[model samples]
Target: MADNLRGTSGPCPACGHVVAFDASTSTDMSVETVEEAQNVPISFTRPEMPEEVMDMTPMVDVVFQLLIFFMMTAAFSLQKALEMPPSDNQEKTAQAQTLEELENESDFVIVRIDRDNNITVDGEDAPSDQELLNKLREAKLGQLGQGVPGRTGLLVLADPQCRHETVVKALDAGNAVGMERIRLATVEDTAF
Candidate 1:
């Protein structure tokens, strides 16, 4: 009978009896009349709630670190530029010459680089870099005998499809042979 009435709080079905319980106290129950149970007062309590919070210190620190890294690695200014003298106003400056005019000049030693990246000196094929350097040295010495010490110029005529490294190598070879005056010319494309 007690098991069946464990959680019940109304009048008993078998008899006209009222039962009351105090959960704060022991399991011992109390029997009362309906009128007496109605006269008793009941109390309730609200449940407690937890507080919510968020921390942003670590996130702010990481953002500042990234900003500092980028600021330190960024390029802010350019390096120094080369210094050149201003042009003379009194002297009459000559106009630029065409490729044909330059080619016709007898003082220039023509060095041609074909589309196949082959270096040729005065229209003759140079087998290797050493051979080309020797030929350039001999030409410079020969030009010296003609009253042109540093006046003998080197004109490099290169095909458009030739590699830039090959042109640089040719320039280096010319410099190695003590050729002071060097000029570059780009050949017109005939594919169109």
Candidate 2:
């Protein structure tokens, strides 16, 4: 069957004689002729390359525009704060005073708040908030007249049973009278 397919037993039309032809041999001869040509060495010369070019002007312009837009739209605020000036008459160096010296100080004013929410100055009952403020002002004035070297200190003595609102009111009154050095002292006395 293969010989018939390869035309090995076929008769040639031109010669009218029995001719044998192998299809595989003819295909192999064509392939070998192409491979012989491919095995010959050939030199390869590269074409000249064009110069590379890149423009960054547009990108840089866009970046600068974005920066300018943000700078123009950004909000800047000036912060407000309370400025305190140093006291010229007071000594700059702080001297630590003992508890005994503080207790024995004659210039210290005591503001007491009892459990009943009653305000007192130096053990004397103040009938109203106005009266307390007036007393605090008088103490400030007295200290200034006496040529006190520092600010007048107000010691707030609040009973443990006193309401927080009452204590705040007492502190507000002291602040209203311009008392800077206010200290809180809690007393454990059960008596109102």
Candidate 3:
């Protein structure tokens, strides 16, 4: 049937051989427009497209979900923070005490961090966190808090060249064993 339609078949049993015809070859022009009319063609072909074309909507949705999940679970600052009481210049100045005064008093634990990052609790070495915690806990046995008040406290006397991490560790250890009134100061107040 297709061969017959395409005029490729042999002589027909009723009429004869087929003749090639084209509608666009019409000898007459349009009556109203006076222009040549083009033949509108009918097609049965499937549109051409690449075999590997993919939809990215699902992948994008999955990526967004994963990003949200990570944003929800990721830790920004996990370690506990110190509760700093809000104050003005007057209160801060009133609360401030020199390292010399702290040294003279028997109320402070006096953990010192030298330039070499060596930690000493009241002139004794505390080389590890556990030892530092033990020392701090023992020193702060009955102290409620620290300040200009006559309460016991932990004093961190650090050198200028000590690593910031060492100081943070000391402060964390102090906080871990409930040393609320923790004070930090440099070994010498003078700067080069």
Best of the candidates, lDDT:
1
Better of 2 and 3 by lDDT: 3
- For model 1, state the Cα shift of residue 153 in Å: 0.4
lDDT by residue (1-192, candidate 2, tens digit) is 232345334444445455444456344333233234334333345888998888899999999999999999999886433224476667768786654465457666677788777888766778788888887787777743344444476777788888998888777777777776677778755633
Per-model TM-score versus the true fold: 0.48, 0.43, 0.56
Q: Please, what is the whole-model Cα lDDT of each candidate in the order they appear?
A: 0.69, 0.66, 0.68
Candidate 3 lDDT over 46-91, as tens digits, reads 9997689699999999999999999999989886688775766676
Off-target runs (Cα >4 Å) in candidate 3 are: 1-53, 56-75, 86-96, 142-151, 188-192
TM-score of 1: 0.48
Ranking 1 against 3 by TM-score, winner: 3
- Superposed on all Cα atoms, model 1 deviates from the true structure by an RMSD in Å of 9.4
Clash counts for the predictions, in order:
0, 0, 0
Which portions of model 1 miss their true places by more than 4 Å?
1-92, 143-151, 189-192
lDDT for position 78 in model 3? 83
